[model samples]
Target: MQAIIFVRLFRLLLGRQGPLLLSLLLWTALGI
Candidate 1:
């Protein structure tokens, strides 16, 4: 369940300045 959402977010953010933003998002997600 989480993996699926992670993958979708990864794809969506891949084109952006992703490393920092991605880590932040992943952290926030996990924090939830």
Candidate 2:
């Protein structure tokens, strides 16, 4: 369920790749 939502949100934000990647990377790094 989490992964499914994540994929959806990921695609929703795809147009802003730079910010999206940075945010995802930051969130992942924070262990959230």
Show the lowest summed lDDT stretch of 10 residues, model 1: 9-18
lDDT of 1 by residue, 1-32 (tens): 89899788787877777788778877997996
lDDT of 1: 0.81
Off by over 4 Å in 2: 1-16
- Candidate 2 matches the true fold with a TM-score of 0.45
Off by over 4 Å in 1: 16-32
- Whose TM-score is greatest here? 2
lDDT of 2 by residue, 1-32 (tens): 89889767777777667686868767997999
What TM-score, to 2 decimals, does candidate 1 have? 0.43
What lDDT would each prediction earn against the true structure?
0.81, 0.77
